[model samples]
Target: MSDLRDAALVSKAWPFEEARRVLKRYQKQPPEKGYVLFQTGYGPSGLPHIGTFGEVARTTMVRRAFELMSDIPTKLICFSDDMDGFRKVPTNVPMQEELAQDLNLPLTKVRDPFGTHAGFAQHNNARLCEFLDSFGFEYEFASSTEYYTSGKFDEMLLKACWEYQKIMDIMLPTLGAERRATYSPFLPISPKTGHVLQVPMLEVNAANGTVVYQEPDGEKVEIPVTGGNVKMQWKPDWAMRWAALDVDYEMSGKDLIDSVTQGGKICRALGKRPPESLTYELFNDELGQKISKSKGNGLSMEEWLTYAAPESLQYFMYLKPKTAKRLYFDVIPKAVDEYHQQLRAYPGQDLKAKLNNPVYHLHGSDMPASDMVVPFSMLLNLASASSAEAKETMWGFINKYAPDATPESHPNLDAAAGFAVRYFNDFVKPNKVFRAPTDQEHAALADLALALSSEEAALAAIAKKNAAMGNEDDLPVADFADDDFLQSVVFAIGKNHGFEPLRDWFKAIYEVLLGASQGPRFGGFIALYGVKETVALIQAGLNNELTK
Candidate 1:
């Protein structure tokens, strides 16, 4: 294990790189807090999105990496800033009028539109926990409401009262003249109207742990900063949380790079060092716009799981996190196949190599074998070619391609097969356009079809001959299900027909036969879908039967 840790110290995997950053924080002395704390903050203004899950998932990867490299105990906190003021009612939720009436109140004070939870933020917090729980993430859930109301934040709140000017000096320069004029570190919860007042401070009584603010009716009110009477503005609150909790590590999106910096300075102002941090690039929608939780334009956790397994979503979150990537339905198939590809490769990887493999970071030492005898992309192609409406239809081809596999024995593949059919019907089926093959393409496809027909006939003839000679048990029959052989045959036909770049042949086959511009390798498709079935498909394409 020590040797593996030595290798992990220099492993190029992003998780290891991040874990190294956290590990380096304590080279001089271990944390006085006894355990390293990792936190991911969530704003419960809206329902939890894929972005929220990404933060926790990515943080867990780094936490797992740190576990491998250090003997120190680690803790992950998924903190919800539910005490944030409910500035505006989200358009995505129900009971908009009720939410509108609760403006300026802390989120935990707003009514849950869904009528399920105690408050709006509570509803979202429950959802966030449920989402994280489904992924089997090990983390403690914390609420800003509880922290503030329960007096967990009292010590930090009082400290901020004393360092009020210093923290303001750090925050004021970053805001506009107008915002700075009205800004105060402490937003006192209004006792009269139940709103979190964002007014300028009239006075700070640090010795008494209280702040005085002018109410809208021109009355001055002094409230203790402790016991939920006040909440710090976001920037100061972020730093205060770190300082109070002695957080060792946390991460946020690149958009918060400035926030991280501002928070760090404020933490220093409060006489505590900021935790080690990583800034990951944000996810964008299919249109390349940044995904927003309120706009509801991006894929949700539920939607992604509908089309693929949760592990595939984890794989998507795991890859190139520093680089921005599109999060949409179209990207799911690739992530699913690539995740399985890594799973299949994990057993062959040595300790050093395994440290870099994503599956290792995802599942740790309990990584499961890849049961996907068929790739996800190939399954989609099968679904398209078969016009499959059900997993059973796709399984018919799967059963023939891998005789030993079944839905019961290979659950991942079975799940993927079901996902493929749903994906095909929803996405692939709608946009598919079959084009008439060009003359050259038509000739090559015809020849390939003829070749497949001949191969099938030859196999049948050999079977008949053996059966007649009573040599069926003695004679070895030629294998018609050879994937490489079928692939080579298609290649030869394409080359013989003078398709300049032979890839054009395959492309044409896809466009003409499958109503797609790109598809799985034709031979593998044939091996899976069967030679005679592929021949029928080709014949249909040649007759323009499919275009109808």
Candidate 2:
């Protein structure tokens, strides 16, 4: 354990690096709050998406890293800013006209369009918690409405009131003259209309913890900043929450860089330092447009999960977070395969290497073994060639390659088989384009098919000879089972038929036989799908049977 901790101190993984930065904060002494506090804020104005989950997932990764390197205990809080006003109705939900009527109301007060929960924010908050819990994250859920109305934030709310001018001085310079004249850090909730108003504050009485503003009817009213009567603007609210909660570490999207800077200044004005933060680049759609929840331009968490396991999504999140990447359906298969690839490499890695591995951060010391003996890409190809409708169909092929494995023993592989079938049908099958082989390629494929047939015949003759010698079950099939051996045979055939550089031969095999521009190693695919079956597939391609 001590050696692992020593390795963690110098580990180059991003999580450990971020954790070290946080660890520096308490080098002189322990925090006055007794434990480090990690927080992730959410806006429940729209449905929680993959980007929202990434914030909490990445924060947890750093929190896990910090736990590994220090004796200090830590706590994570998933804070939902459900108190923000519902500025516009979402186009995706039902009862849009109803939601439009409730504009300018706090999300917690707006009626749920789905008619399922207490309010719009509550429904979305439930979804946010469901996905977080589904991932088994360790954290406490905090609601902005609950904190304000329950007096948990009263102290900071009062502090903001007293430091109102200071907060204004920090925020005013960032705004134009029109918005600057009316902007107050505090937004008062109107009593009569039940709307959160953005009107100019007529007065701020720090002594009484109240702000005076004229109602829409022109009546002068004094509202207490505490007790949910007023909510701070997002920027000030961000700072006030940090001071109130004593957050040690938090992370936000790249778009929030300026907001983070302003919030840090506001926190300094309120006599507290801001939390250590990482600004991660936002995800983009396939076309490179920034993914927007309202615009519905990218894959959702649910959609990603439908075709791959949740860990793959986390694996995607765990990559170079500072580098922006496209988040779309096409990225799923690669993420799934690479996640298992990392899992396979974890056990053999030395301590320092393990410390740098993602699975170590993702699963910690309780990492599971990678049961995906068949790579996801290979499974997709097998499903494509077989036109598999059920996982059981893929299992027939998987069992031929790994005779001892089963759904119970290799659950990951079992689940991936299911995912591969769905992925092939939904994404691959529709786009598949098989072209007829050219003359040279056709002759090469025929010779390759004949060669595979001879290999099969030789294997059968060897099995018969072994059976006559009372060694049928123990026959030396390893040589024939070897992917490289079969690959070499195919390479020899391709080279004999004038396939210079070899990659063109493989590319032709993929485009002509598999209807894909690229595919898994033909040797591995043949080993999994059986030598005779691949010969039949090749013959079908040559005769134009597949394209027909």
Worst 10 residues of 1 by lDDT: 457-466
Which candidate leads in lDDT?
A: 2
Tens digits of per-residue lDDT, candidate 2, 1-548, equal 99889999999999999999999999999999899999999998888888989999999999999999999999999999999999988777888888899999999999998889999999999999999999999999999999999999999999998999999999999999999988989999999988889988899999999999988899999999999999999999999999999999999999999999999999999999899999999999999999876666788999999999999999999999999999999999999999999999999989988888888879999999999999999999999999999999999999989999999999999999999999999999999999999999999898878767776643544454455447646434435577876776676567667777889999999999999999999889999999889999999999999898
Off by over 4 Å in 1: 456-479
In order of appearance, the predictions have TM-scores of: 0.95, 0.95
lDDT of each: 0.89, 0.91
Per residue, candidate 1 scores C-alpha lDDT tens digits across 390-507 of 9999999998999999889999999999999999999999999998888988887887777777766434444454554466553233355877767766766766677768788888
Write down the lDDT that model 1 would get: 0.89
